[model samples]
Target: MQADAYADIPLPIDPSALAALIGGTTAGVGILDTKLRYLYVNPALERLNGIPAAEHLGRTVADVLPEIDAREDMMLAVLSDGMSREITSSGRTPAATGADRRYWHGTYHRLEVAGQVVGVAGIVLEVMASDEEQRRLDRTRHHLSLLDAANTRIGTTLDMDTTCAELVDLVVPGLADFATVEVFPPDVAPTVRPAPPGVFRMRRAALTAVPGLLERFARFGVAGDYIDHQPGSAVPRCLASNQLVVENLTDDEQLGRVAHCPERVAVYRALGMHSAVFLPVSVRSGPIGVLGLVRAGGSPPFTAEDVVVARELAARAAVDLDHARRFTHEHTIALELQRSLLSEPRPPHPHIEVATRYLPADRQVLVGGDWFDVIPLRDGRHLKAMGDVMGHGVEAAVAMSHYRSLLRLLADEDLPPHRILEQLDRMVERSGLDRAATCLLAVVDRSGGMCQVSSAGHLPPVFIEPGAAGARLGDVPAGPPLGTGFGGYRTTEVRCAPGTVLFMYTDGLVERRGEDIDVSVGRLRELTLPADGSLERLLDTVLDRFGPGAEDDIAVMTSRARPAPGGCAKDLV
Candidate 1:
């Protein structure tokens, strides 16, 4: 049969073009009218919306996709600001299908045919491919690298703003060509202030002088300029009036470098940037500053990807900066107080081999008030007492100093171990330290194989006697803690044989997840110290095994019963 001749004309766009572009992957692609009607949709949209593409044509977005949160900030930004946006929506498409949670990269743009806004266009790509095994591995490695760097820098003496700026510097360049960390500082609404043209130029040198920022700035070849008011500058003065402050200033004929509302254009120009985006920066309470990124608008400025990365990084960096500043200030006070409170370690005696180790917790300047005394008594005895006063930070350390002073006074007076506890109890009650405080006091009499101990809300000392199998524990007396007004508490005498080991400590030593406090202490008594011959190594092991979380500071004292020719018998007062 002879084929009939047919004349063909090119349509504005191919009917199958979208399907061909999206392929069989079922990626959602759709077009919307000014009224948000479903103007067009591919098969993927059909699947996502849970309706046939043909059925949805010419329907309003609200009419078809009822679940969409139209008022969302990002959505509002796209509609009102004409800004492009990408959203990831997971769940079964509105079409008839089982509920399936999957991520999508939904790009929204104002559809313009001949220059006027008609409607919106959307393209949604399922996140399946991006979540592939290899990508997961790469993400894991990147996250680990970032955490490693962050961890190392966490406890350093870096200031907040400088640290944040450095962090931004680290992220930019490899990621993009421009990055900035802005601090809004408290109570100052940046949007309301008009930006001055020469403001940037005025503060450029001063800002560049900042410590960490300069080094990292060299790393990325980026620079910074601050906004400041200047005399007689000719610029469309909108920084005092406009909200959206900076735009790409690549064109020589572009508007004068100043925002009517923000007034920071000249600073942007000096900083070698054309396009800049800003986000609020905050420490714990108030807004500390603003974070921003910039690039020459003519030179491929920021993209959706850039915004995504910048926002995520900024959130974490804000926290990091806040912690750094607070930690430094708090640490300075804490360390000074801790040092002042602790007694200087005395030189070793002929019969005593004393070992003391103190390690501050990770990234914090805080040293707990865990104090141990190795006092030589009047009668050739060793009076050892380790105490933990309540909490961490400065207050606890202060209380520690007071307790040590009182104990020393009692020791100097040569009071009995029981009497010392009674006097301490009275002193604490009178000093108003009875609220939220606990202490342990144990007197070790080396000459007499016994530990005369009276405790105030403290763990009893652990005693170990040598045997064929191993060392075993002796008896102890547990009583109410100090500061609780446990009236006239008596110290009990516990026997210690030759080569017997006595260990006393505060609660910081026996803390662990899913373990009872008593059981944890008992475990320490059962386990012998490490053979490495370092008390710090032993304490570090205890700390490492327990994981992270500090209940109280640790105070540990180890001693052995003196093997004497006359006999191990002296007053442990």
Candidate 2:
């Protein structure tokens, strides 16, 4: 039949033909009057709703399918504007043919006669199977995205607290409404014993929550505070079993049991928290801690898929926490070793005053091998030394101690500055110390009124006259660094007037990347000397000027000869 002929067939169509067409198609078809009351329902729609046609006619959608959200508002919009509308909805129906929750796509259009509003015509198709598959794919993609983000955001620093904070920050308001990370104390080994039956202790490392809940949740425990989980708590259970514990707090009793405390239960009620999950943070060693995730009002209870995502996140965070713990332990041991090796220098003779300062590099870098010492020599003279081993960490620190001990033994020989460095270089090379070192040495003879300075691939020493306004770098001869077995070192004699200050330092104080060593040294020489002639104040000013920018370990020492009483040098001790 032609399209125009089909339209001209009749003003009121045959009911049997329309029924046959609606019944033959798979889509569910229905007609609702202006009041949204069902006026007609075909066999397909009856099957979709699990109700016969007689039971659906003359009843509203809410009366027939209360569980399903038919979106009456969209149907009303179609009737008011005579416009068509489409919607995708999900809910359980009486049919129970597939998943508990089924999806459907529906299209609704206005039905009018004589250009006056009459009713709405709706056709719906069951999309449960395909929509379920699409939902699974979307969830998988979301989980993968979270894992990828964890790789870069978590463990960005080798610090325990920082790693903990990163883990919680990544999960809050995305995976959970609130999250917390708590770990066994440093002195307590995670695998040593099962959690106590009465109470379990763990230190809170990090906590984060959705806006408006952070401050309230923080009342339970802040980071660094020790929290004791009461008996039968999910955290303790998760730790002991090394598994996940999920709680759906649907009632006051369930909330009380999961909260483990009356105060927390009240907080939960106020915040409308209804679901929680506790997962063990574990590695090959054992369970190290627990990760807690919670969801509040209107948010769905934790599901199996959510548990899977949270478990993966906890596992990744566990590895990072383990690494941070190990790093912190090593850093502590190295720092102590360096400090012990760099003890205060021995006091020089009464005529000589000396001051020294040692600063390790930033926390990200391990302690380095920088050392300073002052040793008394024969004839009222003192030997001052500053040296830097060419690396960082425990091995460099050990080498530094070796150099310091060997230098003390050679100082007893009353050797000059150059001879001392030559002997040190030979001994270090023979001792199998592979790391090279730069060193500056000065022999101050107060009565002789002259100081002998030498260098072993080290920076030149700076000197300030008693009354001079500015400092000047000493023109000391340089040689190969210690451990090279080179003997080209030559001593430069600088006049040591009464109250003259001799400053010696390692390269960390004056070296900058991409800048010539000479230019860096020039910057140091241009600094005005402190007028009080106090060696302590002189070293303080130098550090205040350059210490903040140093990228390596620094060791600096200053020595000044005191003027003899009555202007008679021979009378001094």
Q: Specify the highest-TM-score model's number.
A: 2
Q: Give the per-residue lDDT of model 1 (tens digit) for 418-512.
A: 78877877888898874344555556655565667676666767654444233344344555666777665667777766555566666766776
Per residue, candidate 2 scores C-alpha lDDT tens digits across 308-399 of 99999999999999988887777778888888888988667766667888876666678889999999888777888889999999999999
Backbone clashes in model 2, listed as residue pairs: none
The TM-score of predicted model 2 comes to 0.74
Model 1 poorest 10 in a row by lDDT = 1-10
What are the Cα lDDT values of the candidates? 0.56, 0.82
RMSD of each: 17.8, 6.9
Report the number of clashing residue pairs per model: 54, 0
Please give the RMSD of candidate 2 to the true structure: 6.9
Q: Per-prediction TM-score, please?
A: 0.49, 0.74
